[model samples]
Target chain A: MTPESNPILIGSQRVRVELIDRPIDRRPLSDFIRDPDTGAQAWFEGVTRRMTGSQQTDRLEYEAFTPMATRQLQELAAQAMDAFSLTAVAITHRLGVVPIGEASILIGCSAAHRKGPLAALPWLMDQIKADVAIWKREHFAGGQSQWVHPQ
Target chain B: MNCQVLLFAAARDLANSERIDVEVPPPVTAAAVLDGLGRQVPRLLPLLPACRLAVDQAFVPADFPVSAGSELALIPPVSGG
Candidate 1:
């Protein structure tokens, strides 16, 4: 079953932030960001790559300090909306073991113009990587797993 | 004073437990809790400096007072994209 979550509204944007234990559906956010006046909608989906340098990664395990992470994500969404003048944002990250080629994260953004949505999507992702309290462990083909984090 | 030290990710791996209770002098501080934790689990000593301390879900400074029964999470470097 999909992990439990609720939509959050900040400013004019309806943000979907969740720490799910199952696969993330891209459709919901796509539908949420639909707008006739909005000329640009940018979506980003991060998937588990099969290879990491010379090592082949079979899967990735994710864990989260949920409450703090959720709080930080909401702050990020609100900041993104204010910073880039975005109309909507939706983000979902997966927990538990995710096999190769599956979506580990999904970020969607919409704006009245292309510039705001385009700029906000990638910036939002970078902020999540740097600030969120989530972790990733890569399981290699040699049956060894390594915990990965940013310096 | 007593506070619950919660471990996550690499900190959890190093300590081999998700939670550890620590006792400190009156008016416990986050640094004292870290010192106490390092003393109890020597393996955590090297990693403690890099870990971020959060009390009751808010990240706090080393000198931040840890209230009784509060949960302190040790958040190591994060890489979530």
Candidate 2:
């Protein structure tokens, strides 16, 4: 398959952001920001689950307003890097169909001290959920589906 | 002039298309775009109140002037992590 449309869209010396259409493997994500000066690397993975409040999810499909999402993600990474004094930060969000147990989003942050990455991880996640232009449609068992609107 | 408003998530489902082209008058504002969509795609209007408008990949106020060539998107409340 041609991965042309889903390659890493933004990157710099300390920041990388991607809107990918495939599964997010956490191995490389953890290693992405690690280096000799890095004393702490914080990682987060958002996985697709089979259940959400008693509904049996068969799968989850992700969609994004690609241009906006990409730009926003890049901004988030940069902001996190600056705010947390991070050595590097990486984020990958998936698009299209994702099976249960697969990761839909991955975030990694590395810093010279533990507090920097640790403090930045959750804050960045919350910001992404609040600001990014991405959505998830949950396909339920027995052929029903619904868009996940936050309450 | 005509400008296309891109739809996403719930808005896309309501409109039944990824985008809708609206015929707008001169000095097209975000309000005018939504008004046009309400007339053309009535199904999309109910959700418009909860959504935000993005012009050229950036969020803007309802009074923001949007050119025909600008990329417009209707942003529903996000659910990404």
Candidate 3:
């Protein structure tokens, strides 16, 4: 099935979880909003950072147990769709080594009213971090790297 | 019965072997396989606390049963976005 047919909104969106190595398009957000006849589409893009606390970070690497991870992410999206009155949702995440200032995750949601999608955006992000099977490894400037868990 | 156990991520890198053959009694459970693995590959003991197991590509908790010819994978903590 196409991404539009099974659009992912909150949990690790379709683009991020299924298309791990491909680049994501921003147009999906606009398209979803248009299709839903909504007045507003709230979007959030999580970018890689150059610094972590006092230490300078070189890059971030991500690895996943592909099959199980994808299943878990899809389940999350379905849950969000049922909980919130959403018209359409799009989510994308990048795997492998992501450089600083690059988008790692993109989430968009459309609803009849602005308040629902707006409030649900952050809540969805939190659920993704907490329940998703993805993991993040931070590489420091001095060649030290550490795995970071969702908090 | 002899079955092959697959390792991934940090556990694979540490063991230096993708698959190992272990002998177990018939109708073994996933937990029993892990116990046998620890005895055969002592190095895996330290990493067990942080690892998970999968059967036939699905995550199975310790109590899950194992059948002969089942594919088992040792999954370390994942680090993906």
Candidate 4:
């Protein structure tokens, strides 16, 4: 499914999850998950770093099984919301080539207290890295490229 | 039964193709298709044991029953930010 076709559901709270082919914007996502009653909000941005195991990376090419990746991401958001008692949660991960210093993934959550959002962000990130149907190929400056796999 | 297995990431690179079709005997299973893939593309054998299998978008075990028209994918250990 395309990015625009992605859904944002609302019931007890809002949950937005998407797989985009462009850059990730943190502010809009942060605002999307904001709630009037929320006492705190947490935002996490994952950027493409320039180094990997002594190799200098110029950029990263991300590929995803779009349909499955989108489904997994939505499931992750729902799990985070339920597990952490979050009022709102949003996750957006970028596809295609991402240059060093560019944000490749954005995760935001809101809760009535700080601890919930704080703990959920990292947990969600780990889940995304481990379970999501996405892959990254690091392109090094020396014309070498390698696929990165989760440990 | 005939089935197609989709490859991704390292599995894709190793197989040198996006998808592979295999014909199996009755009582088809994900493991059967994976075995056929290993025979057709020897390079995929090293990654097969570690890779996960997904049938119609959900992860399934190696012995999970598969049908002729099922959508399958080989998911290597993922690394996403």
| The best candidate in terms of lDDT | 4
**iRMSD computed for candidate 3:** 3.5
Candidate 4 on A1-151: residue-level lDDT in tens? 2233265564665888887888887777877987789999998989999976788999998989888988888888888888999999988888889999999998889999999999999999989888899999999999989888755
Could you tell which candidate, 1 or 4, scores higher by DockQ?
4
List model 2 lDDT by residue over A42-66, tens digit each: 8888889998888899999888888
**Number of the predicted model whose DockQ against the real structure is largest:** 4
**Which structure among the candidates has the greatest TM-score?**
4
User: How well does chain A score by TM in each candidate?
Assistant: 0.91, 0.89, 0.80, 0.91
TM-score of each: 0.92, 0.91, 0.74, 0.93
lDDT of 4 at B67: 71
Candidate 1 chain B TM? 0.90
Tens-place lDDT digits, model 3, residues B1-81: 787988755566568897888886756887888888888889988877666677877778787888877888776665444
> Model 1 chain A, poorest ten-residue lDDT window?
A1-10
RMSD, one per candidate, in order: 2.0, 2.2, 5.0, 2.0
lDDT of 1 by residue, A1-151 (tens): 3233455556555776888888888888788888787889988889999987888998999888888888889889888988999888888889889999999899999889989988998898888888788889999988998888666
Per-residue accuracy of model 1 over B1-81 as CA lDDT, tens digit each: 766788988788888998987777766788888888888889988878877788878788888988776768888888787
Kindly report which residue stretches of model 4 are placed more than 4 angstroms away from their true locations once superposed. Answer: A1-13
DockQ of all predictions against the true structure, Cα-based: 0.82, 0.82, 0.36, 0.85
* RMSD over all Cα atoms, model 3: 5.0
Query: A1-151 in candidate 3: lDDT tens per residue?
Result: 1121133344333223353554556776556455536766788888888977899999887665555556676665566656777666666676777888887778777777788778767877877665455667788999988766422
* Selected candidate, larger TM-score, 1 vs 3: 1
- Candidates in order have lDDT scores of 0.84, 0.83, 0.68, 0.85
The CA lDDT at A15 in model 3 is 26
Q: Between candidates 3 and 4, which one is better according to TM-score?
A: 4
